[model samples]
Target: MYPGVNMDMEMQNVGSNGSEAAARQMATTTGNGEGHTHRGPQSAETGSLLQAQCNGGSVEMKSDRRVLALRGPQDSTICRMQKELKDVVCWKIPLWMLLLFLLLIMVAIVFITLALCPVFHQDVDEKFDPSTFNISRLFKGNFSLLDLPFSDDLLVPSSNQSRALSRDLQGKLTVVYSSSPALSRYFSKAEVHAFRNGSVVAEYRLTFLMPEQQEEQLRRFTLSREMVYNVLRQSLHQQEDHGTYIDPLSLTLV
Candidate 1:
């Protein structure tokens, strides 16, 4: 071999033997309970790298916390907006539903008013009908009287010879006379005295029948007998004065 080559070969052999010896010493120290006691350059470098990684992790955790904190306000805003929208929706009503609700309220108010209010009933009086009265049919009956004038020639002489006169006057009025001797005494005496004086005296008991159910007319008939006598006397006087008589058929009492 050449000298240079021999020198290079020796250097390589020395390097290999040094590395082997260092590995053997490390293994022996680990076996003898001296592991992790010696801090080498590699261990120090590895510790620095691990500390940098831990600092990066802490920075990322702080950024995450900042993001979560910022998101809290956004979340609250969104919740508030949603609540407002729900409130608006709850207040809204359809037109048909609103109208129906108003109608129901009106009906309930009417029902309550009807239940509380009072009701009244009124009565009416019947009216009187004057056309139902028949005057001709009422006077068609037999009645008793005496001492009415028949004619100038037919004069009654005595109480025993007094006759009951049944005569229809003017085809509508009927005059009747009852023959009672006791009732005719005063009229007979008056007739005899009037015959001596050359004048005829006439007297009468008169009753009028009316075609009505009125109590007022019956009351007048019962209370005012002089009124009837005056009316007859006036008629007879008018007949004597004018030589004309009013028709009894056309006369109406009421």
Candidate 2:
């Protein structure tokens, strides 16, 4: 308390006042707060951290003392959150692209499959002619009525199928055309009777005359060679006792 005091006295005075000064500082502060007291110049690490967090304002992490002191404020939290989000999206981008690629592939496959529907052979049309009959050619070609790559015989005509040829004939696949004016080169009647063992149990026919007005009418038929193939095939189903009367359209689209 006195001026010009000796060093020892000054030291003793400081020690005595220390306790009172601490109590007064305490009275000036609010003890109910969660964080610890901040009296001295904070370390660089803690100061910078606090300022950065303060820039983004405060946040209450469960309103705990430990959280306020350790976690600091919201800016660092937002920065950390942003970093984590960036990491997650970076990893997710490839997966998103992969899923998109897979979906595209599936769509392409479906489109291609629908486009190739006629490849399984659309229908059978046959013609029989004793005069222009060719036994060897018709039997050798695909037995399938569908243009698809399969055994032609597998496609059993629907119940409404008409038959023109007899059980008596057998034939092969051959190109038949001539300038004789009596017979064009495209197709001929199949004299299946030439074979003793071979026989015609059933016949099939597909409608080929495209609708006058329809989308892809000519395209569909021509795409499968159905137009020309059906013409000659129609004649074979017209055989005597073959019952050319087509039953009700068995496989009606509608």
Candidate 3:
């Protein structure tokens, strides 16, 4: 401790003591006593970790240099921005691309839906019609009066307008004017009158027998009714005539 006695050794000892003291002070200030201080900055730091001490490693005990560790606003801001930029650069591109791709897919789906909306149709007539099948008949001549094969099979009459009289004819004919399901009653009691050359013979009733469903027969009966009425009108003189409205037999389908 004498002035400059063993000067070099004393200086070396003092330097070591100061380094130990600074290390202890840093450990205390950082609150890193529990093994954390061992991982701190290396000996290359060369300066005191704490502020208020000047010459870096060692100058003289009392040098005039003032130690100040000041980070300006610009430097602090730049460090924070660098960390944030690194995070975004590492993870944002794929996420943004995924969002854009989803949006494009949704737009394409909407456009496709709009383009294909007008291609649907639904109006069909499902009723079975005889005209849909190709068959023709002439019922106004003497050939039709010959005893048809249908004479024996007709079930006499039916209940509920008409019932299971002819299972064979049920699906075969489109019965137009029927108050009953069985044509058996009409076939037995109805009459036939024929017309030729726009002139009809006087009305005569004939039982025309049929084995098959005859929509054509019903149409023929209707035509006969009209022709007979007109021929009768021609026969009577208007001054002496009283009108007779013959009731066309009403037929119904079951």
User: What's each prediction's clash count?
Assistant: 2, 41, 8
lDDT of 2 at 4: 56
What would the per-residue lDDT of candidate 3 be over residues 1-254, giving only the tens digit for each residue? 56667888889999999999999898787775554546445532544343442322222322235544454566667777666545533345544465567899999999988777754433343233434333322222121111122322222233321233223123212121122233223333222232112111112233323323544665466334453333323332221223222122211111
For residues 1-254, write the lDDT of model 2, one tens digit per residue: 55656877978989989989998778667543423454334533344333224445554443223355344456678887666545533445654455567899999999999989978655433233334422222222212221122223323332222222232122321222122122343234433221111122233222222223332543454323544445345543543343222222221110
Q: Write the residue-wise lDDT of candidate 1 on 1-254 in tens digits.
A: 59999999999999999999999998998966755776667766555422123311321223223332123455667777666545532258545456668899999999988876744333232234435433321111112222333453335433232332212222112111112221211111111111111222222223333336754664465224444434433453344323223333233232
Comparison by lDDT, 1 against 2, better one? 1
Off by over 4 Å in 2: 1-93, 124-254
Q: Which predicted model would earn the best lDDT?
A: 1
TM-score, one value per model: 0.19, 0.19, 0.16
What TM-score number comes out for model 1?
0.19
RMSD of each: 32.0, 18.6, 22.9
* Superposed model 3: Cα runs more than 4 Å off: 1-9, 16-22, 25-30, 33-136, 139-254
